[model samples]
Target: MSEATTHQIPGLKQKKVFKIIVLGDSGVGKTCLTYRFCEGQFLDKSEATIGVDFRERNIKIGHEDIKLQLWDTAGQERFRKSMVQHYYRNVHAVVIVYDVTKPETFHSIASWMQEVESHGLMRAPRVLVGNKCDCGTPESRLATTYAQRLADKYGMPLFETSALLDSECDNVESIFMTLAHKLYSKQPLRVVSVEGELGPGVVTLGRQKRSASSNDSCLCS
Candidate 1:
């Protein structure tokens, strides 16, 4: 990584880099949610995060090449207590998650959000998600009215997502895509000179091909 990354929408090497931080209480499926976003397949028994984990994926929004650096923060209080504030610094977006089956997890979002406000860069695009919606009726427990109100209050998109559901795969991807677009759209486009005519059609990210190890866990080196 450079000493610092730029947020320019496009350039000769405009990668449209964005650092996204995923936060929630432990067992809220933060890891699974991230893995699903990065790998497009859910792991029901993936290894638990001891402190933090990360994965990167590149995407395209119009002609801009966008790269997402997703940081999966350990949600346990013990881990949070010792983590430096810089862990949340200079982020381009935030993803706050909770378990739909667990009301307490949803309730804990306030404290989690507060921690973010205290530590994170201001005005980053934020998303709120209710994970693990695959196991049960996704809408039965959480009040959509209340969640919408919360989202409106913070100007964030709220979603009830299931990493395990094929239908919900787009929802997970949309959170980051929307954020990337928002960041890219706001900036003035630059006319960067390149060697030849750019190819047509979307450039595949090449990250969707995830293979499982001998123990049946998705592994990406």
Candidate 2:
């Protein structure tokens, strides 16, 4: 891990921080995916996150220094209701994960998305992930087409990845880095805009413009 430099270069922009929450059912590998990206190592075993856990990583992209605060939330029904508000509060992005081998987990994505919508995080950059791909066989895994269809329905990109595999672990990093870049580029700070001559100004933020390849950009390649 590289230490953040204390010395500041003249004219250089200060580091930007973003908060990202990972949501999924227990055993869907949310914690493992986060550990791989932030720690660069696969977690062979982990207990269910109690309510929430946080991890931070410093990265640079195109001359921009970024700090990612990844919040790994507990996926159990018991823990969810108590912490849902806190999890969605001030979140810059959302990552919805599902186990490729288990179709039920994939089905639960809709409910999870509904949770995001209920908390008014619909405008936050969100992505869908099918995890543990390496553990599934052709007979057991859900088709990529179905996953893509869900992603298309939600207007978000879909990535199929295995955090436990050395070869595919880089995809895990790509997933978060892609979101970091998107949030950094959007600069979602509060801004006041005048709508009419005799009306009060409106404050707007969190709106995003979709790119040509945004819906299909899978960094797994």
Candidate 3:
């Protein structure tokens, strides 16, 4: 990482901005994962995302202030095209999530990665996340060994986490914080970019909701 001079968004003081797109099959808890990270609480219920939902949070990593913009994409096939065309631009990282209890959803990880690579984003910092660990029975859950093998196939790290547990918030925090630090460490500072309204085919059900603040220690190495 270069200690080079950084630029800023017009009204913001963040030293860097990282765009992370969250992808997974429907009902895999993609929205809840982001809600937990941004709000520090589990979201009890949420509507299925139509095309995409945008959420953001500001955090201080060491002495540097950074903003993380998360794009939660809809999992349904019909909506995937517009999302791929519009939201995949300028993404710094990718989080491909799956439900621990549903093996079909887990199986869909290959397709999600194919979508990412289809957009020529094969080299972006990507991680595999198995969500909803708290709601599954041992007999019903997919083995972590399998998830690890798949992650290994892609040469990315795998993290198994639960969005519904307050006790597991640190695990949730570590997922994104790890990505932020990785992106910040390896990339050069670029001007903060903003997203315009999704025009034409895309459905934008949720506006961007900003997190309150970030006054905490780095949870990942």
Candidate 4:
């Protein structure tokens, strides 16, 4: 079956909001992944993403519902000002992607890590993604190794994906869902209760006993 036919599966629904940011160097295919996952569509011929592009898709994990707000940012160095402006806030998870065919792109992981930290979003769950994995050759294995090291450094998950071939696509949504579940579970719970008055409320009863004891001591003096 053709790629077009596969994406036409019916009745896909949108659930909860999960804000995910895609970060990588220029020409690494961040926009393509966002379009493929959210719109289920692909364009072989396209321009680089400008400042930002938005896409949304509903994903389900067991009994939980998730809506992914995928953000595709421009990866060019000249666009740093615009990129930093949108960095950090409201981001639940991040997917730091790099091109497997371009080793330099893989090396830029350190810079990307710095960007994440500078935005004060280092605590957010992150996934290191090696895009164009179908192009992986003996030469490209080196890039993969570097990608793994970055994943280890950040204690983040790693995925080698091909937006064109749909490789690793199934696992992508689950990664976001897992992050969402972890974030939700870490939230503190608050409880409130009401009680009926006793012979006296605890505060009033304690105060009366203290006053009586003081009065007896004063009489003795």
lDDT against the true structure, each candidate: 0.73, 0.81, 0.82, 0.69
Question: How far in Å is the alpha carbon of 133 misplaced in model 3?
Answer: 0.5
Decoy 1 TM-score against native? 0.75
RMSD of 3: 12.5
Candidate 3: residue pairs that collide? none
Q: Considering lDDT, which of the candidate structures 2 and 4 is the better prediction for this target?
A: 2
Which prediction has the highest TM-score against the true structure? 3
Better of 2 and 3 by TM-score: 3
RMSD (CA, Å), each prediction: 16.1, 10.4, 12.5, 14.0
* Candidate 3 wrongly placed segments (more than 4 Å): 5-14, 189-221
How does candidate 2 score on lDDT?
A: 0.81
Top lDDT hit: 3
- Which segments of model 2 are wrong by more than 4 Å? 1-13, 188-221
TM-score of each: 0.75, 0.80, 0.80, 0.70
Q: After superposition, how far is residue 49 of candidate 4 from its true place, in Å?
A: 0.5
Name the weakest run of 10 consecutive residues (lDDT summed) in model 1.
188-197
For 1-221, candidate 2 gives per-residue lDDT tens digits of: 01212335244357767899999998899999999999898887788888899998999977867899999988898888876676677688999999999999999999999999988778788999999999958889999999999999999999999999989977998899889887766652311111222234222121122333554585764
